[model samples]
Target: MSMSFGKSLAGSVLALAAASAAQADVPQVATDIAPVHGLVARVMDGLGEPALVVQPGASPHSYSMRPSEARALEQSDAVFWIGAELEPWLEESIDTLASDALVVELLGVDGITTLEFREGATFEAHDHEHGDEPHADHDHDHASEEHAAHDHADETAHDDHDHADEASHEGEKHDGHDHGDEEHDHEGEDHAGHDHAGHSHEGVDPHAWLDPENAKTWLDVIAEDLAELDPENAETYRANATAGREEIDAAMADVETMLSTADDVSFVVFHDAYHYFENRFGISAAGAISLSDATDPSPARVEEVRDTIRDLGVACVFAEPQFNQDLVATVSDGTDVQAAVIDPLGFELEMGPDFYPELIRSIGDSIASCTSSS
Candidate 1:
């Protein structure tokens, strides 16, 4: 089996190339939510894409794993999740999959001042309005005070905003600031605080990524986790995230610009997913919706929002691409708020691989176009 010198070197190079390709095969990281996929996509931006085991349209809160997805989970290098409380269904199998598979429940890692659900708080935020109460049109510097308090509270935590996003930025937790600290007279500006305990806010404003700032928080953790899981590719992951995060930064800039000039920058959303975006950009909005991801407004609830829209002079009524637009129309029938669609799910947008960033941009564009035009 003697070979020429050049032949032997060529053969060795070929073998090494093949081995590298096989080794670099992207990890089959299964996510508990679509937003996690966004994280994964950003992490894998320079690297290859991971297999998206769980998909859109499927409810992560109550999703049933298929045998194939189960197999993928078992084979995955890591399963990045917000936490079991956020996605209860995946808790059972998280440990059963594989011993080597790293299950990262990031909710624990994020440092937030969480406000536990009052009582009987289910996944339905629609069971109640965002936070303690829907805002009335009042010009209060509530947000500034809320941030001061949150920073004051986070006075000690390592991960300040990260914990807050893990808590989903429920309006109530921020609104739940102590009465003595309630200096802001603004109607809807009281949202602050993070639930570091991870007890539960039920499902109050679970679309943390909707806010560009929170998306950056999650990406920081995602980049760190990816580095830990694959130290060899640490540079690649960091570089990718740093570059990809610019998109989010740009999106934040865009949202800031859009909301700054919106004359009647307000809407009644089918869902309360936009609170983070609205609050972040200072866009005043009213909703005939609740905090839960899949809650429908009741007749009485619709009327309440309708009245608010009329009173607040809300410009647009928003709906999700997946939900019933008819409901939004029916509720906002005679009000000045025109029914428009906004997607927190990232379902309809062309996000390339990084769906979350694209989703944020899309949301910003929609908000800007709708509000400014209104």
Candidate 2:
């Protein structure tokens, strides 16, 4: 064969190998939850499917990472999680396990407004008392109660001051920096490379996805990030996200319409996780049975909730899949209040590109079930 012909053949082979290498560089994405996976899945449609870390029926709050899941994280090009507040177990693991992977916390993304746990929600903030204050002249017990109230008021004021100061500092930081940078901190001040540490989990609700608007914000961010990572699929990602937003908007409209007719709808949930959902849709929950599925309320607290149920004439007592149903039964034992199961985590539902809309609809359905009764 001619030397010139041999050289041309070698060049062709090298070009084909380079093309394969470029395709390999397309990111292998990983997400922490089913709904997040659902969002990412839509953005990556026709490009590739993302790996899900937490599977259906598992609780992200208390889930232990498995060996295979760790390996998936290590192999991923980018990892998307809600935030450390929702999945605290991932806080240490993602840093250690996926050290090289690009980690994006969805809650930290701009345009997504976060909700706080209701002021009087069952997850009461730890009351750190200030120094004792002098009480007015009164009976011993009355004076003590007044002093305690004063201390609480003082603590609340101090917390408010600290939070305001932190917000000012955060605003200054953002004025000179990019919004989506992992290092710039989304929740007030930076936490020295730990974004989660910057925000207090006590009052900040981590279930931001429950709000359709937040989900729309998420789609925009997801498409932007995915396009940056995979330029070849930029149009596809953006187009899919746009379509997803439209679907969410339409579904949310329907949800609002469906639940609009219920009169005096009052209920209780298994935990404080649904504040985002309840607040976004203009639904009011009486309270939660517990702060979290991992923590059980005391007998006295349980009795108090029962009294609340009786007094308020609650329509339904909603239970979750991760926790036991016995508590729900006990809460509604002799009452006419209906006991309904609402799976916030989509425990029994199928996970895919459609999971997000379906999950939202399920929540609407559960609320409608009891509210429509009376």
Candidate 3:
């Protein structure tokens, strides 16, 4: 009886060891940013932790991967990123270092909604009278026509009204108008030229992670990719992803509740990175201080943003930790606008499965706080 009992105990121990070994065979996953890393970490919760390429608080726009990060990419079985648009600097490194890894560009994933980049530093005020519908869905053709008609009327009025003083100031006014036109044209060209500086993609905004909907979609994508790489833990990966999606849904609901009072509040961002978040929540930024973070706002662009804030009665201006805080102060100075910091990258948040949802809530809280006081 004693010998038989000992045999059974040894058999049970061996079976437990085998189960542990099987569970340990997770794929080596690497992710680009903190948010992406957090999503991947959720899907890989019990399986393993994925390596983060770009550390939190570092700008993915102009990042140089360290040797350790490169080594992680080199050893990875799979790699995920937003794509070349957000981190153009990582493309070459991925091509060379992660040659064998299954590369998944989250931005190109299907079912994810991508928004176009707002053209200038200052954006046109978005009309939010349509409940829950994003400003992107609105037809701007009518507005464009009205603007053109107004410009034509202004030209006609100027031609007819100023003849009394025009004789004396004609040469001065004509020269000034021509010079102004030339300077405007030059600035436009300069802005257009830098559109591809940090983000190579012309039309698609790469900051899709700001939208909780997109993050939910990406959770499934990450699970499927990880499942393909490590079929042994496929069920665990998928279960984790489903749980993550549910968490995101809960977080989104909380954000909606938080921002319910902020519908009428208008604000501006340091740059046009929050459109996805704004669109998702049915809120909108009045304008951006700069078109892209890679380039500084031109003097004219700064003045335009100032005009937007004053004209629109914008209540708040958000600064990002990744960029200059002085710019936000400058834009909000001399106005009744309140200034606050919003970090989309989840830089200060503890990295893990909870990071994404917390990041979303933090953003909502930041916006609500400023708008509530104003």
Best by TM-score: 3
lDDT of 2 by residue, 4-37 (tens): 9999999999999988786676688889998899
> Model 1: per-residue lDDT, tens digit, 337-366?
665677776766543456776777677777
- On the 0 to 100 scale, the lDDT of residue 263 in model 1 is 35
Provide the TM-score for each candidate, comma-separated: 0.69, 0.72, 0.78
Ordered list by lDDT, greatest first: 3, 2, 1
The model with the greater TM-score, 1 or 3, is: 3
Candidate of highest lDDT? 3
lDDT of 3 by residue, 1-374 (tens): 69999999999999999988876678888889999999999999976899998887666765556788999989988888987667766766777888777788777666677776666665553233323232232222221232212111111122211111101111112211221121111233344324322333245678989988888878887787777668888899889999999999999999999999998888999878898898888887888886643345666677778988999899999988766678788887899999888888977899998889999999999999999999
Q: Which stretches of candidate 1 lie over 4 Å from their true place?
A: 1-26, 58-61, 98-100, 111-204, 351-353
Error of 1 at 266 (Å): 2.1
